[model samples]
Target: MLYNNITELIGNTPILRISPEVHKLKNIELYAKLEFYNPFGSVKDRIAYGMIKEDLKDIKENGKTIIESSSGNTAKALQILAHINGITFKTVTNRIKIPEVKNILRILGTDIEELPGLSECPDPTDPNDPIRFIENMVSQEPHKYYHTAQYSNMKNRDTHYKTTGREIYEDIGTVDYFLGTLGTTGSSRGIIEYLTEKNPHLVKVGIIADKGDTIPGIRNVDEMHEVGIYEKTLYDDIITVNSLEAINGMETLIRQSGVLGGPTSGGAFWGTLKYLEEVDKSLSEKKTAVFVVCDRVEPYISYIQKRRPDFFEVETHKDTIRNLSNEELANVNTISIGEALEWVEENNPLIIDLRGNMAFRTSHIPNSINITDNYFEELIDAGIPFSNNILVMLVCPVGEKSNKFVALMKKKGFDAYSLEGGIVSWRDAGYPMKPLNLKKKEQAVI
Candidate 1:
């Protein structure tokens, strides 16, 4: 088990059988290929080490700083790889909300440049956007930086082909289906290529995030791209899993099977369930499928909280025992994020962030107090700061749960109003959601 460096510990991640209740329906056997067991805690550890180890000459000569645009995991893996190799690394990314990923990149001394605002897909016209930003940097400073651009990098997919794909075949000889989330298309491309080579009939389900959804480590439908060795024609099925389903899948994995994986893994699992449910019933019977566990779950706690703390009551009000009508629900106190912004300007509003701790830390209205989930219980535990003069505003990813909570808070004699449209709308309206830790607002907004 001894190794010269952590890079040596990159591949050979363990795969475990997943027999959760939610996945029990169609006589299909699901297994999770746990890439988080890798040293840097994600599958990207494979590609990061693979690319850098291949380019020691380039790194030693001209790679003053290893640079790339990333959603998070690959940049993190590259940061670790760069640290060991005595090279600096920089990241060009959008507003990455995951606290764990951000902290690691920050602690590693990564020169991160964050793009302001959210755009579902990369706009070709915008020079300061995600995929384009990296291109601009590499084009501008080819001598000063070496870009490990995962999207278009052949080595990115090739590494997975050589190691990740080969490992699965060597471990479990007959994998009926290979399910993977589409990120840089490295993992899926590699696995699909190798697996299909062995069994031409192997079902390749490419998982993608649903439209208007932002699941980290994987691209949504709007952001889809075919870069590097990515062959779109190879996929037997392309499944679009949305954000709520992803959260449910992640929670199921953690609670039922003890598989703590990131949102991409959630999307992969969601894809598997969808494939079984909607795809041909003939393939559903006694099928063996392997899904990629892309990364560990620590990076997405905040997102998890926004969904609901262990309660998928987003179908909503089930636990209320007394259902509130649509008119009653509509009557709950509310304020626009703009109005809330104005209130905050003149006076202090006790902004009770109902999103998880990490999400609050990632971005929240200034001077807001975060309350944990199990809503009423956590509120009681923290003790109410309610008073007649005090303005209390509740926040969540969207306004649904906040509106529900406002109903409960009003009955509790607290003057609480849900911030209409939640934080997403606030950001959508071009209001600034401060990137908490990073000091440079202009240079690096993450």
Candidate 2:
């Protein structure tokens, strides 16, 4: 279809049904709103288009360039939207995002601002730090720049309320549960607010980052992205799933439904499945569950193919980590840093530092082994135990990488826990460390 403006392509994404085999147990109908069908190949297209249009409406008297912070998909969508409207686009993103996204941004002539350190924030509570960085750029360059502020932008939620929510309600009419990921909380909050107003019985379920407590129902302090203040108060219920569940779910979508979606979208789909199973057992009549297939998985093709070659080959393994209280991990399981330190001293649990080789070599917990030198296969081939009996604490400079690796190991049938603060926190806590010794001495130049 031809469109005169990007705003014209804001909504009306197609919805597809999940196969009967995929929904065998629940016996309830499952549908995914294929949001990738949007102009930018992601659901963020609606928000990017809507926010720009709204910003333009109020500021028609003045010209403004668009700016925002995004990991990948959102940035791409905004860039495409801004370009079509003849507005200059600038994006502040971390260097750790997928290379394909960076390539797209560069090709779109986006003035790229790269943030120092990890791409995703480690602390969700400190939302201002990232926004401040973006604000600094806007201050220095006053050339008609407006920040989209996805994390805290009410417009993001408004877009979904006006477009996506209406489309779903029109298509399904009676959706018992509205499920989606909690990246910015815009989609969930918008849909929940709109649908709940129409039908108070509609339940909104949100899937949050497993490392942190961004989700209302789950609690963790680890840093991860979440919807901003304006977007937080829209959900009825929330669920948290770790990287393993997300990855497995992504693989399942490809295998079962031929729907290749990103890890976050897969988590949403999995959460929806669990919700359906629960509601089915309780209710006498069949209920409908709908989720947004936020984006296509093509961008992650290289990373997943390289990291998880056997991901699709294996059958879905039952998750072994029981849902335990924080006290359990701290007291009974003894995985907390303080307790783990004691066990490290007494039992010498195999500590594999998952951080970069330089970070691992610079300083680490005493007696900790460095596994970053080789790939996972080499480490496993070199006699690393693959059983859950072994106590393994994956360590990094910070906790994010370690958390991701620990999740992968757990999926491979290993008992793994991430060091809370990674090596940085360990060093700050006055823990003992040894620096790598250099073999060659450098001479001073005049």
Candidate 3:
């Protein structure tokens, strides 16, 4: 695989067949398109290279540096493309992105800028907010930089249409459904647009994070954080999955396929499986579903190694509870600040603050125990009991992590609930906090 330019490595990813038993769907063929083989080790390589070339063509007429904002994979792809093209590149991302991605970006000589106050933003919407900030910077300093606004860039889709989409269509011959995670919607949308032209009945499914009104593994209308403006018009259908479902599915994929993809890949796989189940029940004819294995397992190695090492070796199917709707999960057992106080007075329930120790030390629910991530597993291992008959509340800085932790506790055979809006909401609702005080003695000025 000798290539003179990064752009030359844009398309032609390998397709592999996997056992249907692992996916838990009967009488259906499954295939995975390994997009990680791209130059940047993800499908975003095509988009990054395409957007840069098009933006450069429109702006510089000759040659110029590139600047963009990306969370992980896109930034790495852009770095590779820029390095090959002899263009200086700068990437702005938040601090909480997977550490391996930051290291790769640094290795590629990208001028990295970390956004402030981004740790609390759990979703991709806020994580991608740096795009606007970078746009502002490029507007003021236009001479030396070009911004590849991936969220809104048509080139992202164009590259996929020109390369990945065509390659899949040519290789598979007939793809009943195109499944992939919905980040910018470039990969799915591009393939849909290209393939639909040939096969009008082809289905395009976009997988989104479960937030509002959306099903756990199917589509609905919600403010998708990673879905860009282009996606609304691009996707034929959308599917949403909660964090737990995504995590569990990721574990399942690693166990079955010996491929450890990230959360987004798991979401896509789950969406495809659910779709196949529905199709199997409805149609008699055999169906073939294709999903994009969007990225490699390397960037996520550390995360899975630390949080779910058991999944690294075993491929056991875990049953996920999907009876509770997102709305039910959002509001179930949630209490307002006043209501929480009143409930605590009446029930005397144990409130476990899920926020990290630092935030818990700053201030927390009155008399709540600080069981941070560091000590959470330890405490659970120590046989800390939660009375099933009594109310148990989990609290965090914001609601997302608390919700996830509550789900984990529930899965671990505990009747637990999470405080909606967490500590921020409690303070916003006029709750008082007991600030920690350090022991200090009067001393002479030194």
Candidate 4:
């Protein structure tokens, strides 16, 4: 395993066969592509080096900074590679939800330019898209920066095809099914395209997070369309897994198979099992399936603790939104855009916007005060911030977060309602929105 340089250790990661006793699949042999074994500790290492290796000499000689839109592994790998080769690396992204990932990037000397966009996936409509920002920067001074646009770059997929796909085929020939969490869609696209040539019947299943849910390194179903590398036709089926399901799946993999993978890996595993269970019932022959273990879980400790505080023996409030029962969630009061408009005029309810301050300053419902969802949760932890007498309304990007909060509020005896379809619906309904214009000094204070 000796190598002259770390880049030499980028690919050829081992694939582990899951024990039948663990997965409990009667007719299928399930395997996990243990991609975390890569030198940079994730599947992205292959592409990180692939994207820059050919151009490394030119980039170094020209003194061009390596830049990309990445919040996690890709950024980490590129930064390390850039440093080792005497090239500056910059990460422009809005998807850094995990604090540890951001801190790790900073520790690696990554020049992080964080934008205020909320979605982990690209939003073509969003003015602050990281890819769009990078494109603008490169266009203005092309020689100064080398933009490795992972989402759109063919190199992202080509590298995976040449290495990852080839490695898998060599280890386990003619994979019947390939399941992978869709981030840049590079790995899935490259792997499936390669595998399909070997086995025409190979089922390619793409995993995504549920709508309005966050799973680090993967896009939600609603956001998938905005990704340039994503092709709906490429996947035989698409599956959605939630944050809780992802963690649960990760735990199962860790305890049962000793695969120390992250949430994205867990999501792929969860989706794979869910899809295969039904297929197994009708199968007569031996079939093989593979899912990717994208990265290790150490970086997501805070993310895990926030969702499952009881794991750490921390005291959790009974009325927390995450703890809401199915019945409570189903009963959350929600008002449609038309109904909300008339209701607002008559009831004069206290409107609370749960989006970030930057988004709030851009545009929000008139007279609604921005609290940001995290701070709003803290206020609830302390006790009722408002009297039960006043009618209240909760707002968010979509209806999801507001719906969950409203469920908890109802449990606490608050007369609250969530705006159906949230602020997006209100905007589409042509309701007037107010934008707060803050001076430079006031912006700094905020």
Candidate 5:
């Protein structure tokens, strides 16, 4: 039962039968392969190490560094494994929206080169973007770097074929319908090839983000054409899921089954449901559909907060609450950082963090509860009693959102104060802070 290292725990992820509540169908027997259980927390852990392991001796002997152009699951997997193996890792990343994932990359001491251009699938012709930068690095000095070109590398598709594909077939003898999102398309291509050979009747469904919608690690058809690893012919049908639907699926899974997976996983689930809605109920119930839960939810929590805030928003639309007038809401007073710190030292207040979960995860006041809205009142009313005179200090990245929220809470007869200058000021004032991890202390030791 003991392993020498985390890399040994790469594949053979557990598959759980999804609840009918999340699927909203009595017809399809749905199941999800939980890839978040992988050592670095993603399905990509399979290919990240699988693609690079054979080349390690050459890379180390030649004094070359491992490089990849990624910001999501792939980046996380590479950084963790590369560190464990004593390999120098560098990332070509753009503005990564997922704070928790980005924090992990930074914490690993991965050499990060930030691409100013914001496109995930930037034009290959643009020499400044991450993808093109990778091209130049390896093309110019091939020996100085070992690039695991995930998109075109058959190794990526092959690794999944050998591991992910074999595991699913062994676990569920017959998969009538298999669903996976399109990014590198390694997982889908591998599974589809292996399963169809086992059962020619298997229906392969490829999920894609709707046009102009941004779901992490998924691409539309037009955007996917450049990736050589994707197999268009294997898919019997391609389903499109928008950003909101994906988040809803993610939230539904968490609330119903207590399983936390990223939006790409949700996109696959949403696509499966969409597909079920179009098929005959009698036939679907007789079949089994398996979806890959691509990664964990921690990275996308802030994204979910921004896209569909209702999931985390407090129940303030009830009749038990009085409606606040705009005039009274607008004039609520704000408290300075120093004043807020002084109040914190003197009294125990309910600190509500208004920033997105990722931002709050980066740094916040200790013991503060992370919430999207003024739902702290809901908690208080629900019998986690608070004194009428006690303060509800609202913290944000900046003062704007918290100020408006402060105004609304004031009108509703709650003693609320917006921390002026927000968390940015808290750091500027040298106040003690808390992070989602003990990364600060760990970094000091390292």
Candidate 6:
């Protein structure tokens, strides 16, 4: 096939049938929509084009830079498209968890402004949320920037409805079930709308990351709120898959079916089987179902290795938090908000905040030192960085991460306790917080 421009190569992706022997579903025909076949190598290519193509001329004429709040595939696609169209592109986001994804965006000449909060989706409560930050910037200089609000834009959903949904129906007449891992929730919403017209009884299942887990290109329960295009009523069921399960699903697709899909695709595959397994038992006839293979897997090598180090043959410390036993996890020393003030005064423990540097600077527990979670993990991998006799108190946005670290530290014979409910609780309880004064600190250094 010959193409005049790369934009022409955006849609009409091929779908593959999962072997009956592999899925082992008695009455279901499973299909994988190979979205990675698109020119920029992900399902986001469709939306990137959909969001920008109409405004490309106006944006170019006005010399406005195209901007969005993306840290992954959407930013990559938009950057490439912007380059081809002779326009500048910028992305403002929270700390991108995947190193490879960040490096790729940087290499593509994307102007990235990284914030401190770790939520993959927009958080309305967060003052430094990417959407709010972009809105502020656009308000200040509307002529200087063109913000493509992917999270709320109807164009994102409409593009999928016109192309992705139409192509799937043309290939397979009617879809009995549709499974899609939710990121911006655009692709899933678009497909469900179109396919439901073909078969009103179609089951729409939305996939997300489990609470306190990070799966790239999807939102966890806390981050799911405040998304403009997402509606809970659209889905028949919502399934939560963790990083391990997502990787397991990715491996299954790669090994069993030879589909080179990323963790997001793996998550969708995992969630699809979980939901359909129950439906299969009650089904009287064979039904067709489709799930999207969101992207290729090569970019997420570090992500998979971090969660499953055994796969890469990289050994962790014998007492690493990753290897914490259930007993150790259960027995972590925890202090509530009321107890925290008294405990801090009595013990004088070395307080450690595990939130990102940006958040740490905004406001944190007085006398607390900031070591972002990833760096802290690296410190543990080398060996414990603290004295055995010293008392330690760990804190995070919420208590979950800090609790896990406390468990590992306790196993290592350190007097460590996790602050119950974390810094959020401490702030809510009217405890004093010290804000880092950047100007004063810089002047002092000079």
Per-residue lDDT of 184-289 in model 2, one digit per residue for the tens? 6678788878888778888777777565322211222353334353343566766677655666777788788888777666777777776667677777677777
For candidate 5, write residues 333-430 as lDDT tens digits. Answer: 78888787888878777787755444555566887876643344345346435565767887766565576566766655678888887777887899
Model 6: per-residue lDDT, tens digit, 135-181? 99999999999999999999999999999999999998999999988
User: What is the Cα-based TM-score of model 5?
Assistant: 0.68
lDDT tens digits, residues 1-446, model 3?
57776567667888877787787666667888888777667888888777766455555454656777676778778777666656677787653336676677777777888764343324222223577778788788777678788877888788788887788878877877777777677777788788888788887777777653221222223335434635565567776666556667776778888766676667677778876777777767776778887775666655554444466774422322234446545544566666866777787777776544334555656667755533454455454555656568877666655675566556566777777777777867777665334343111110
Rank order (by TM-score, best first): 6, 4, 3, 2, 1, 5
Q: List the residue pairs that clash in candidate 6.
A: none
Model 4, position 365, has a per-residue lDDT of 81
- Writing each residue's lDDT as its tens digit, candidate 1 over 1-446 gives 57886767889898888764657756667788999999888998888877778776678676578888875778888887787777888888864766677887887778788775443322222234566767776789778888877888888878888988888888877788888888789889988788888888898888888653568877776567535556789898788987778877887888888998877787788778888665436653576778888888887776666555545344432333024456667789998777767766776767776655445556666656556434443444355545745667877666766787677666656787887887777767777665455453321111
Candidate 3, pairs of clashing residues:
218-239, 219-238, 219-239, 255-315
What's the C-alpha lDDT at position 410 in model 3?
A: 66
lDDT of 6: 0.87
Clashing pairs in 4: none
Cα lDDT listed for each candidate: 0.72, 0.65, 0.66, 0.86, 0.75, 0.87
Ranking by lDDT: 6, 4, 5, 1, 3, 2
TM-score, prediction 4 = 0.94
**Looking at model 1, which ten-residue stretch has the lowest summed lDDT?**
118-127
After superposition, the stretches of candidate 5 with alpha carbons farther than 4 Å from their true spots are 119-127, 282-285, 314-446
**Which candidate leads the pack in lDDT?**
6
Q: Estimate candidate 1's RMSD in Å.
A: 8.3
Residue 207 shift from truth in candidate 5, angstroms: 0.4
Poorest 10 consecutive residues by lDDT, candidate 5: 118-127
Clashes of 5: 1
Q: What is the lDDT of candidate 3?
A: 0.66
